[model samples]
Target chain A: MKNRVVITGMGAVTPLGNSVAETWEGICRGKSGIGRLTKFDCTAHETRIAGELKDFDPLRFVNKKELRRLDDFIIYALAAAEMALADAGLASGAAEGERTGVIIGSAIGGLATIEKEKEAIFLGGPRKMSAFTIPAVLANLASGHVSIRFGAKGPIGCSVTACSSGACAIGDAVRLIAEGHADCMIAGGVEAAVTPLCVAGFNAMRALSKRNEEPEKASRPFDRDRDGFVIGEGCGIVILEALPRALDRGTRICGEIAGYGNTSDAFHMAAPPPGHEGAVRCMQAALRDAGMEAAGIDYINAHGTSTPLNDAYETEAIKTVFGEHTRRLAVSSTKSMTGHLLGAAGGIETIFCMKAIDTGMLPPTINLDHPDPTCDLDYVPHQARKAAIRTAMSNTFGFGGVNAVLIVKKFEE
Target chain B: MTLEEKVISIIMEQLDVTREECVAEASFIDDLGADSLDLVELIMEMEETFDVQIADNELEKIRTIKDVFEFLKSRGTVWQE
Candidate 1:
């Protein structure tokens, strides 16, 4: 028999907030976390605004000496993992070291460190490069650092599927636990790619919003005036435990991982396929995996990226999958407030789904003032809604034509 | 600064140890609490600060603070007493 996985703990270090409580509060209040790119000099870049984090200090989670050696993404991942383990009431040494694992995801890990080292090499000589650069810049170090910190010895890995990375990590964690490879897994995604090169590169591709004057209202998902996604950075992590173990320990079950589906467009490097066939298949796969029908899902946390093509295509995909039930479904894009977290989007959004399942509150798509005619749907706009969500789905579509969907449901005996 | 003083400061900063702990006979790994990676980083810092390239073969010969001082002195590079 396949083991069931339950989410016992959740944590997030987001642009909206530093913790789950703060982020959820901002989501419920329709507050915008997007702002000017203050981390670096964006004078040369066309896209100046981003969902940059505020008032985050690594010292609270890591020592000063060690913090200097780690990249910002690794620090964020470590902080989120620490918060998750604590929330689960599991001491770092409580679980069997061999049965506990970590699988954190990132699209571009340690880009800041790489950029700094490159500058050093140019200004000074090759000898000026720091020896810690390799470990600090590798994408897998998010999981590597977490495993070493928490003493989790089993099946440590990382997923790097761009924007879908986090959701894929969670999905992989569920499979690991279901296959009895691990009793518990610390899984999610972290990203800190809000550096000069990342911003300039995205701007070159015209993938970021250039709304410098109005940063708060910049990420208007599914709106007629929406231009492109606003690049954001953060981390989100959750503790996935076997349902039986969680029940045996009397742990609080926030939600259950019912299904996960990952697919590829295989058409374009950066654009969705025609008719969003991949996304439709991806959602259908998730529903099939959960043994659920489209009508069974109570709400959908969309992958509404606030981009022109993504929003319209995702809407079409939803209409195709949910059919007539699309009108009644409470679909919203938390990215309207959080902006697009890229790799960390799926992790944080899944937590939103869990929050909706636990608290019966549907987060709103904040900046959906004038919805596009083609993208018309009930986006739970403007304010939070009080609705009993028994089953929720979160969607994440990334560059490289990757599509990932996760289904979560309220736990019951 | 003198060569010894400069080398000691670099070691202290890179390894995150105290001045008193960075004695001449102190081993980078044992007394200074530096792992292999830390030692490598300290070497990089030393190279950048002194503007001298320490080759890979020479790194294996220098394991102690005194060894580092002797290596730099033998390089015939400009240094103060």
Candidate 2:
């Protein structure tokens, strides 16, 4: 009998908006956050547009001294964690310390810091580097700083599994609770890699969308005219506590993490295999873990990266797993609005799932003007819909062929 | 600004402290709450701002703002104050 893990709180800072409330509001209203890329001058690059965050003030979350030493990714992680702890009523020492943990994941942590320090070394030799450069650029330092901020002493780690990093962090947090290692965990993913080098590297590999003329119409997942994913930056986090502990504290339970699946295609570095067999098995594994049938799921928040390959193959993967029940699944790709947040996608999309289960409203896959011939699922398109959904699944597939599926459902006694 | 004012501004910005607390007699670590890393960053910033290099051994005597002022004076930093 594994311990039941319940989500007590959630937080997010996305291209759509800075807070969970704002981002979800943007999603519910079917607003697109994709815009012109201004982080760097991409005058010669093939892809220029991106999903950039707006008005994100890091000073509100960290002190000036610490901010000078910290990178944007770590700052975003800390901000999301602070919001999550406050939402969980643990910020003021309500329920924290030894039994709590933090695990933040990022596909590429501190890319801007790395780029800056490299320039420093070039301009004034290695002696010009700041003393805190190493800590600022380390991939695991996000979780390290988050743990220090909240004094969570039990288990501390970070996941770096490309785009699946955030989902893996949350899933591993669930494992820790079920294994009796922690009563609570602050888990999620963050990314702030929208720098010159990162964008150029992705463009060199032909990974990002080139729809610079009309940014809002760019990230059209499942549409026949879909391009590549628009790289975005943000963080998403949630507080997961054991059901008994949550009940004892009388906290408002958002949802229950019923099942999780982690798999890999092992075929490509950046592309999925022929039929998305890995995704199929991954969803099956989640269902098995939840003791659920295919018909039990009422909604699916698809990974839907808006890349030509991902949207169509993901559609096939859904059909393979759910079969006839795919017709009944209210599937939507909030990435249509939020863009592809990479490692942070899982954390944000998981919150979208919980919000769906709580509000009985399914977010839409915006800008799906022309449906692909291969993509035939009913993707709650263009407009948000109200549905009494009980169970929701979120799929996140990352580079290096990693796939993670999480099943969330409304809480029941 | 004078050399003394330039060095004090660098210290203030690097240490993230108030202007009033950065008196000449105040200790960098004990008074301004600077750790070893903060001292290193402060030295780097000062060196960059003044366009001069201070040897590592001279760091031992730089415990207070007065010591920094004297060190800069001894290194031929023109004291306009």
Which portions of model 2 show Cα errors greater than 4 Å? B79-81
Best by TM-score: 2
Question: Which digits, one per residue and each the tens of the lDDT, describe model 1 over residues A59-138?
Answer: 99997678879999999999998888888988657754899999999999999999999999999778678889999999
TM-score of each: 0.96, 0.97
lDDT of 1 at A369: 84
Give lDDT tens digits, candidate 2, residues A1-413: 89999999998999999999999999999999999888888888787888888988888998789889999999999999999888988888654589999889999988899999999999999899999899999989999998887788889889999989999999999999988999999999999988898888988877788898999998999999997889999999999999999999998899999999999898999889988999999999989988999999999999999999999999999999998898988899998998899999999999999999899899999999989999888899999999899999999999899999999989998
By summed lDDT, which 10 consecutive residues of candidate 2 chain A come out lowest?
A88-97
Candidate 2 lDDT at A117 equals 96
Q: What proportion of the real contacts between chains A and B does each prediction keep? A: 0.67, 0.75
Among the numbered candidates, top DockQ falls to 2
Model 1 share of native interface contacts:
0.67
DockQ of each: 0.63, 0.81
What shift in Å separates residue B8 of candidate 1 from its native position after superposition? Answer: 3.0
RMSD of each: 1.8, 1.4
Per-residue CA lDDT of model 2 for B1-81, tens digit only, reads 787787788888888888899898999999999999999899888787666798899987789988888887887877354
